[model samples]
Target: MRGELSLVADCKVVRFDAAFDITRETIGAISDVTLARRDAVTAMRRAFAELNGADVPIICLLRNTSENGLRDAKNLGATCCLSAHTPPAMVARTMMTQVIQDRADRPVRSIERGVARATEVLTRLFDGARSNGPVALAQVDASLEPIIEAVRDGGLTRWLDRVWTHDDATYQHCLLVAGVAAKFSLHLGFSASDRNHFVRAALLHDLGKARIPLAILNKPGRLDEGEMTVMRTHPVIGYEKLKAAGCDALTLGAVRHHHEMLDGSGYPDRLSGDSIGDTVRLMTICDIYSALTEKRAYKPAMPNAVAMAILSDMKGRLEDRLVQSFGEAMGNGS
Candidate 1:
């Protein structure tokens, strides 16, 4: 199969201080990045200078909405500005249907609507949804389906392997990982339910880590054996948490067994062979791929080829078929 590129559209990664509504904007080229607290012109000039010779669509985002968003973008050679408040889902859909498709003059009103919805959700979450107005997790869960539809093809995993892959907190990272995993599931010819399960697992696979001590969870160095033992409890912790939170069997399976391997080398349970089903297997593969490709305090993200090679060797330690498919996809990507 030709490798499908699902860029980030819907899974608005909100862990950072800055984000964008680039779901609709094509990235031809991004040059020098300039930050502006108030001056969009200065930022634009730097971006313009960076792409002086490159002839491609330039993309950038601002921290907050400035009156100069459009004007500054025009001068900076930016096709779009994805600010913190941009609607990720709308940006994704527009990029898919228009920018990526090379259509002209796509409607802006629809994108604005997407931004509005995203902002609303973001406000509720950051506003302490649990204790304040008490927004249900299901409400936030509803938001994910739309984002998933938008971001799976925007090259979220592939584009960030440069010098520094950005790191967001757990929840945002989960959304980003799920975006790529959901796309991978579709490419694998999984059914709608299957795809949905992957999306859910991808988003919540790390939920157990929330229980791990912060020292170990965010540790910059490799964990010691005792710390490793505590880390292994994440699967169980995550599974119980999800079960309590009412996650289904499929999602629970992924959360529980995402670490297990075919040859019986993984954690939680050294599940091997057919015991490791396709969905969990796929999650395992996607998890490794996403982690290696993401920026982290521990290490830099690996290149596609290098990560695949490591995965290939680990197949003896993981499931063979999943590794094969992952390798094929990586080759197709390259």
Candidate 2:
């Protein structure tokens, strides 16, 4: 059986007479397993216990096994079960399919974990804001690493695709911005410190929105003038809260001025070009791009090309050179 499997597969196949011979390390090292025995159900149970939480696929080939035995094997973690007479080629195909599927699912699982971690951090921070509890900068900083790593592994397109489906609009936008900022920083070859600061700023930029009334924050349509005025106060709200929590200068600046414009046309503070620091400038571009690309109840998500075009059109409002760099970072090119 081992020789047949080796002939069908392109990789080395190890044979073990007893299930006890398969160690956790061996399970981790192998792609898949083929367990053939008269007592296949018991063998499968033992194999699954050894697997613990590892995701290796297992195929059980049972001789004279009853339907109940096959069902028991499946319940015990067998990925597939077949009669012992089944051809080796068929088993090889099943193994290949499972391997391919596991590979494809890895990125998605990583993204899910990243988003979940970010959500936990954001929720704690936002809850702290509402209750005036102590805010932990360390926790917030740690949260960015998962997201940064996820973007690095999955690419910006895949990150965006997953984050766009997040349920909470506010959380979704923050996650989107942080992911884009991480990707942008990588593209520019920013140092580790700078990249960390960039993603940290993106994650906390909208922390002020936690104080905004939910009715206004989640409004389905355009805000009236009065609502718009209240809605625009998020940057200052976030800035002051984070400042009190002992955040650094770059974080405070981005939290306060991510909405500020280079042409002094933006709200909260109308500080023009030179007054707006580089952190805020880079953050503003990421912020706007995230907002435009994010799907909202009132509007469908904008296409990446259209959003880039909009940025290009804001020649006087956003830093022109930075905008070009941002275009390049997003793979839109100069």
* Index of the highest-TM-score prediction: 2
Error of 1 at 187 (Å): 1.3
Candidate 2 backbone collisions, by pair: none
Residue 263, candidate 1: Cα error in Å is 1.6
Model 1 compared with the native: what TM-score? 0.58
Scored by lDDT, model 1 comes in at: 0.58
Q: Please, what is the TM-score per model?
A: 0.58, 0.73
lDDT of 2 at 21: 45
lDDT of each: 0.58, 0.79
Residue-level lDDT tens digits of model 2 in 132-160: 78776779877777787788867788888
lDDT per residue, candidate 1, 1-334, as tens digits?
0011245422223222233333333344332234554354554465455443232345455554477655666665666566645465544443455345332322232223322343345444434322333323465456554544443333333323311333444544555466557557656877776676677677668767766777887777689999999989988877876676667888889989989988888888888888888788888888887766666775665677887877888847667777877666555541
Instruction: Name the best candidate (by lDDT).
Output: 2
